[model samples]
Target: MASFLDIIKRHLALSIWAFSIIAGILLSQTSIDFRAGVSRLAMNSLYLPFTSFSRTYHLLRDRRVENLRLKEELTTSKLRVEALKEAQRENERLRRLIGFSEKIEYSNLLAEVIGRGTPRMPGSLVVGAGSDRGVIVGLPVIDENGLVGKVIAVNDRSCVIQPLNDPNFKISAIDARSRINGIVSSNSRGKIIMENVPADADIRRGDAVLSSGLGGLFPEGLLIGRVGRVSVPQSGLFMTVEIDPAALLDRLEEVFILFVGIAGEGESGVEPPEAQ
Candidate 1:
């Protein structure tokens, strides 16, 4: 009952307009004198209501169209703003990479990340440069932070690189502080693991780890990461070690591929690249 009353209230204006139309039709049917002045006055009276209704309808229609246009303009403005912010961030990252490359000894090719490796293969990324730009397999890649990965496969225009955190990746590393040698590998969770360390080794938490140059693949003294955890198996003679990589592998966008061998090979402390 209350609902029915609310519905009727909402449509009361329409109902009144319909009722007026019916009442006017019934009045016209009555036996009335056809005087010219009275007929003209009646026609004028009926014309006003329909003229107001038509004007109201057109005004409401125009308002709705204007509101839609404003909403579209707002949406487009938001998208443009976001695009500009992203471009600015990318420029900053590139600037940092260029500065880091100039400080390093190796001649490097700045490569942009094009895509990621297949889901079946973890810790791999596809870079924009390939054999066409002299990018060869086994070239080391790094960013402003530290070592990123090594090129595994190369094509004419692109190449695939395996990051240091991949399960199958391994590097000969040493404790930077104590000068102790160890083998670094990745576990299933992509965490760095230093294996085959004697239980009596002089390693502890927060020790810096770096490449030992034993494998001949990576240059000596490249920053790997810091030690996180140290434990010993009850039966084994060696200790289990966890390492944190110097680079953030998951969020890399641009990197430098080392072709000249060592960082700061020619001269040290060069000027930073100009910001674009």
Candidate 2:
């Protein structure tokens, strides 16, 4: 009897708790205010996490954009700095050329070197002045030290010059001390070759060479270079002479274009320069 009473009491308690929970659920579903409050609570819980995720994503995207913009700005700044440095170097070179030009006696136009010729045709350069500037073909170009090249081709605003070291270049030259005439030409190695020098020629090492003005192309008495070596090859009729150019061909930045035509030929009335 005692065990049966205990069992009944436990079952009654459990049934009452179940009935209470069912009653509360039914009441919550029937009330519109209660249902709205539950919906809002659920939405609020999801909103916080979603809003945080969205904010974080946008912040990362903005940072990435900012970094890219900074990188581009840095690159542009670097390029500007390099350009300024290059301009400074060019200005210094032009100033030196201008001072050298003032000392020249002949009427000449200062020209800047714009470009060099292709590898197939080495020892040639293009200048900034051409026919429009009274520049003409066959005009001799010179630097501070001595002769550089001759104008070969011309355009409205630019001209091509064949340097003294060009293989196709040849000029009549003479020994300043011995007064011996020889044909100075350039070899494939861009080295000066003075040929047709007689075996008994008075030419010797360290002798200065000058233009002879024999072909009427180049004027007389322009310094070419000093003879470096002289050799009498076996079975050769003429001696092979090597010369070092007076001008710095490898570092030419500016050159003076000699106007060799008659006076009143152009507006500047440039005349052929006499040998100094």
Candidate 3:
């Protein structure tokens, strides 16, 4: 039951054999070297086609291997580029942090933000410095931008900071333009707002809000945020004002622990910061 293709293959093989023998005989008539003439004929008619096929296959395989190697090298280069970019960005951040620390008059301890708040201390962050580094509760924490929070709890290795966004965190803020007074606190939803503003207060949107140094907790003139919105209460003596925090609290990486005697600094052996 040979198919058409099988029958053709058999005939083709026989024709090849006949052609090789005839070509050898004709070449052998004129050529003085009989073995060399037959060998040349067999090489041209039989071995050359197979050799050409093998060479093409090897070339294609080598090209594929080279392409894979190039792809691997390209991927490695991309990863290295990304790592370098990250390093450059980190370097810039540290430079800015150092510059801010130098400009401030207070003696500050540099601290790294290690972790976010836990369940026991919502809306807070853990700093790498603790009592061992002269960090104590009530020390104000700040970043390159401005005031961040105050240290609330400390252990041997770390301390927790109650960020401005915390529900219980509050500071006396004032309008830098007009010296109008108000209290800055975060709402239950973590939105920062200025409370207890007089109804006819000169405070307005775009005013710079700063710590007034009234509560004896935070130092004066530290930036709190810019006033965003101002509203009047229907039946109250004060206006409702919202202020944006100066520091990017959610992305905090490092901060300075201001060593001013805020509160509860006794028994900690920390030196008082010089007045500005």
Best by lDDT: 3
List of clashing residue pairs for candidate 3? none
* Per-residue alpha-carbon lDDT of candidate 3 for residues 188-235, written as tens digits (9 for 90 to 100): 777899998899899878999999988678888899999998898788
> Which of candidates 1 and 3 is the stronger one according to lDDT?
3
Best-to-worst order by TM-score is: 3, 1, 2
Global CA lDDT computed for model 3:
0.86
Please report, in order, the local distance difference test score of every candidate based on alpha carbons. 0.81, 0.84, 0.86
Poorest 10 consecutive residues by lDDT, candidate 2:
261-270
lDDT-superior candidate, 2 or 3: 3
Write down the TM-score of every candidate. Answer: 0.73, 0.63, 0.77
Query: How many Å off is the CA of 190 in candidate 3?
Result: 2.0
| Residue-by-residue lDDT tens digits, candidate 1, 1-276 | 999778778999987888899998987776666556677787689776787788899999999999999999999999999999998988887777778878977667788888887576655999998888877787778877778878888898899999988888888899999899989999887678998788889998999998887756787778888999888778878998999888878887888887733333422222222320
Q: Distance (Å) between predicted and true CA of 175, model 2?
A: 3.7
Candidate 1 Cα misplacement greater than 4 A, ranges: 1-45, 119-122, 261-276
Q: How close is candidate 3 to the true structure, as a TM-score?
A: 0.77
What digit string (tens of lDDT, one per residue) describes model 2 on residues 1-276? 988778768798887787789998897678798788887998689676787788899999999999999999999999999999999998887888788878766678888899999565656899999777877788888888888889988998899999999999999999999999999989877789898999878888999999887776777777899999899878767888999999899888888887654322433435633421
